[model samples]
Target: MSTGPAGHVARSTIRPHSETGVEGRKGPLRTFLSTWDGVRIDSVYEPGAVVYEESGTRSGRPGSPSGRDGLVFVVAHGFTGDADRPHVRRVARVLAGYGAVVTFSFRGHGASGGRSTVGDREVLDLAAVVDWARGLGHTRVAVVGFSMGGSVVLRYAALSRVGGGAGTGGGEVLGAGVDAVVSVSAPARWYYRGTAPMRRLHWLVTRPAGRLVGRYGLRTRIHHRDWDPVPLSPVEAVPRIAPTPLLIVHGDRDGYFPLDHPRMLAAAAGEHGELWVEPDMGHAENAAPEALLRRIGEWVVGRAG
Candidate 1:
């Protein structure tokens, strides 16, 4: 175990690219990052091919922007996913072509502490990971989130722009350092139960039986309580992310959220965001193709500067 920025402990494992799905001379640097509220988040950093360095130490000092050097893609996975999940790793691997990648499990997911508040407080997790990427010598940081994570990236970008948010780290100032944001397969509003899949998901989160299945079957731990006062929705958050390049990608055939969800977000984004209606695409990271990931990388490379 080694010490990372802000005194966080990091463990580096040297595994083959075939095993990890991360292409690098050295394997990924795994660490536990502390959120502002003190939740220990399970995180991983993979150096991209373009910026691969063999440095023994990489995390930079906090608040020292001058020390930041490259572009880093911070990935927020969909519900029930952690950094080690194959789909999440694939997304990270593809985005790494443009720059380094930082992937983390949300609170209560994977090895992360606490329980999943779904998308409400997950903004804190994304904010902390983005800050970590910036501290790792990355001058530019872009967030790419899928499904439930997609809502989080949108909220995080808005919170960063708006200064502080309620229930998101106790109104803590957050997400200020983000350069760009991408939200794929996100919903427009909260409490959406338009489709059969969503109805089933609602049961899974709201019912005792579903939470039990989530923990034992899917390896996901969910919070028993519901959102009180409700956090800002994705549509409400998009209007505030001005001048920060925002990309909203949704599949035409997404089962969880239909095309209308992306449409609502796009309309709210106005001229500040770009919308892509992927043809024949399904949903989230599990359904994203390599070509789509490459296009996203290209967009980040062009806009994140």
Candidate 2:
């Protein structure tokens, strides 16, 4: 990556050891996400958790991607999912299998730093995590964000003409200079995320959860004034990531964002991004065929390797 106000710099990271990986070559990734039955975790940006502590192994034992680039994967959870959400953990484990260092945490869900920004300030938190991971010696980086987290990654990468540059800590604009991206049900419509039912049913459970997060001061924790979720949509972000490769996987039956979101992004990005519409999956579901995951993995390898 070019070095300037938005250049890459050295950061710190803590590495953990385990007994698993894709093809058993890259070792294992420590899963820092907590479980649903566990207590809520708090998010902190103070870098007090020891650059790279091996919090734990991802729950489901996912292997590395089919290819190898030694790039890191920063997985973001959904609107209702914390660092420990099953699906989130699954994505982490799978990316770890490919030998990529994976990370996800309870930004607002619990034990992370800062409250949820609905996707606004939380994107900065994601940038922090990416910086921390890069500090650990990762040269190439990829992002996999689900639902709301997905939108955050997209907006973070967009940077566009705002919220970029120095505010990102030493020129690291987007999550450690992402080499590739895969966003599942990333909200394309900020103004209508919750209001759109069929395309956003997965968020039906998130609406109440977001309000609960606000009760926990996530609104104040993330914003300076009034809080609104419309600021997190990817619809306007797709074209911002000019040369970066992207894989947008959307469910034909999504209940939150209209299918048009992915379609519009695809149309906007053209050859720069790939759009895949699942035939039978709902919003934020694990129903995406393994084939799609393989494509995403291959895409990362194609770009970063």
Candidate 3:
């Protein structure tokens, strides 16, 4: 356990059993750590529990591989979201049904330090969380991100393959590589403010008065500088994620980003990726239905295992 800025206590622990002990239920271990760039990140680890044991292997889809022993999911929340948000927790809980789960808050959101560079600098935060998951003894790690986080996961997966020292702040070490990636409701390009919600979001990050609201009201601090060389767009990063399984999920009814966004990403991903155009779903984590989330969980378990 350690103390972070503003006296936030970050601790890591693994419990063997829950108080109720509902047969095979287990507890989650949480910790707070810093990225290579020195940004604090709040994280949680949910140990895989045995929902049903049969023939020395857990049950799963017929003809599919069983025994999800080493799979772990690192879930990154959308804009204005954190590890503790109900929607984030819901996604974590669903993923936890299959294997271990890791959920975290990006810097400038929740209790972490530094300002949100939106999707640009958030890749470092996901890298750090993935590193921590690897350190926790999980051999196969998958990254799942929503909205802004969706873009971050795509970029992280792409950047991580270009060797080890690109985005980790000047010679700093790179985190472990991700085995699978799931991006929900992400933008293919940058500076998109076509929808009302996105226009409002743009105002929140670009305007001084809106940034004040972001800092105090939303608990998210916005960085003022523009992208120096213009970070890779999600579409540009998708092709680089090849050989590694990629899943791009978006809602047909999403008001924030239209179908064109996911379509663009899926096209760039080529044969290495799968696309799910959800029916009647809205935006990001909040709008994702439980059924859709379960499908996503199943997808991660199948691929990451």
**TM of each candidate vs. truth:** 0.83, 0.66, 0.84
Tens digit per residue, CA lDDT, model 1, 1-305: 11113322222222212232332224577777776656788888777655423352333222222222267789999999998899998998888777778899998899988888889878767777776665555678889999999999998787674233322333434554478899999999999999999998899899999999989988898888877758789999898888789999999989999888999999999998999999999999999999999999888877864
lDDT of candidate 1?
Answer: 0.78
Model 3, 1-305: lDDT tens digits are: 11122222122222222131212325566667777557777777777643324443565422211244667788999988999999999898787777777888898899777888888778778877876777666667889999999999998887664234333223333356688999999999999989999999999988899999998998888888776657778888888787789999999999999999999999999999999999999999999988998898778767767
Model 2, 47: alpha-carbon shift in Å?
21
Q: List CA RMSD, all candidates.
A: 8.4, 9.6, 6.9
Query: Which candidate, 1 or 3, would have the higher TM-score against the true structure?
Result: 3
Clashes of each: 1, 28, 0
Q: What lDDT is reached at residue 166 by model 3? A: 36
RMSD of 2: 9.6
> Which digits, one per residue and each the tens of the lDDT, describe model 2 over residues 49-73?
1122134222233333332333567
Candidates ranked by lDDT: 1, 3, 2
Q: What is the lDDT of residue 67 in candidate 3?
A: 40
- Candidate achieving the largest TM-score: 3
Question: Worst ten-residue run, lDDT, model 3?
Answer: 1-10
